[model samples]
Target: MSPVNTSSSLRPSSFLLMGIPGLEATAQHWISIPLCSMYLLALLGNLLLLAVIQSDPSLHEPMYLFLATLAITDLVLSTSTLPQMLAIFWLGPRSISFHSCMAQMFFIHTFSSVESGILVAMALDRYVAICLPLRHSAILKPSTVARMVLLILLRGLVLIPPFALLLWRLPFCGHRVIPHAYCEHMAVVKLACADTTANTMYGLAVALFVVGLDTLCIALSYTMILRAVFGLPSSQERLKALSTCASHCCVILIFYIPGLFSFLTHRFGHNVPHHIHILLATLYLLVPPMLNPIVYGVKTKQIRIRVVRVFCVRVA
Candidate 1:
């Protein structure tokens, strides 16, 4: 649905501009490059991660399994929007029809929700491994991991569909043009001619339920983890314990903030600078997948070595 300049599917503004999503057209036109570059780099990196994990039998643990799944999700999340997004920006009619736009919105959210929940699960895994060292293997067994993943996937499945359906049921005769590049919930909801009070309210509730709640749970898990790690009077023990999660925390911060900003922008940020909106929107979709592999690899020494080994052998 990402139509570009020549597609005539989107009405052209005679006022010439070149921006992606800024005060003027110039900035919007240019933003697509950096964003696309980030997407490609992230895609390649995660793919390498997947290959490394798959090839190395020694890496087949609950953690590496999770990393592989996360990479797959990242790949889905990035590819879901980027190609169409790039096409819209570079090729032709940047206009997506109503249904197509809604489909994109659902996918972006679905994969995103999955990734968030998975991160929480990972945090819990670390918590158990640290706080219950004796029972770490028993507690984080394959069955337990499977159940956790199943529960979260269903949670996303149940929560998102009706909300998306509710949006589809709405009539869209208002401002047809979305000021933002992607078909985000806030951006798309704003375009609906229908009373969006319910949409906005439930969306906020869900955001609070998912992001806010997930953040809190992850924080608590880390607190317990830190407590366990610090109880070990040895500094080396603490550093090793902390290092595994530090990168994931960084990635989590990157992942959650943009969605929060996007939600805020839709509600309170009407007069927000379009540049900020663009940046947040880009970051929301860009950073998680980009940094996902790096996080897993840093925490996963063998996976890192395997990644290098694969590439170096190819070169040799």
Candidate 2:
């Protein structure tokens, strides 16, 4: 006779997404309050920027177009993770299927790669406008911007699939609880029971080679832009050129500095608390999306004027 099977015989098929590892239930509840506020503010700010750019004919320049694209990317990036994060915080449905986790990881990395590409493109836009003013219009026509956008999408499409496939093939037979607020690629890979050397090396390659190259190109572009701006005869002209680039530079720093911090924390900070790693990683993604619109809206004169008009119209 065979032994009877019972509920205890069932194996686990899902992973528990630990939102901000080491946080108590009460802390999570309190944290969600600020998180929700930031999400709402980011959503409103980005949508308003898109609307202001789209509705104004004067704002149909290449610079504004790039800003609009950045806003769209920020919107999607935050939306991709925030809802599920809040769900875990609110309803306590922290369990996510393996396949679902894979999907989330794909988007998180894809959007991040695309954002890197967009920042490079924005740097080039500024370089052309500031350094090669006579040819800016000819070089960055509407068709050219369209092509750049296409290339941005294609870059992520090509580079991110191998990452997702690598993760999909891994056998995750160990603990199914992820110690983070979201399904970060490296975080998920750590849960795998199989050899993960390839994943680690590939991830490092993308970070160092792919994203690092983009950062280098941006720095070169700005270097040339600064030289050209300083060559101007009038100090006011140089200041204006520098001011125009300040916003982009600020956004670039916001996006990359935390990314570097998180990368370092993950690779070298073995003694650091797990929750600290999770916090830095989450901030690397979160703070930029939340702050990009605010930076642009406050720094760009045209955007600020339009934003005031929007508020006045609403108040009326």
Best by lDDT: 2
For residues 103-127, could you state the per-residue lDDT of candidate 1 as single tens digits?
Answer: 7778888788889898898888778
Model 2, position 82, has a per-residue lDDT of 89
TM-score of 2: 0.93
**Which lDDT tens digits does candidate 2 get at residues 210-242?**
678999999999999988998999999989999
For all candidates, the clash counts are 19, 0
Q: Which RMSD values do the candidates have, in order?
A: 5.8, 4.3
Clashes of 1: 19
TM-scores, one per candidate: 0.88, 0.93
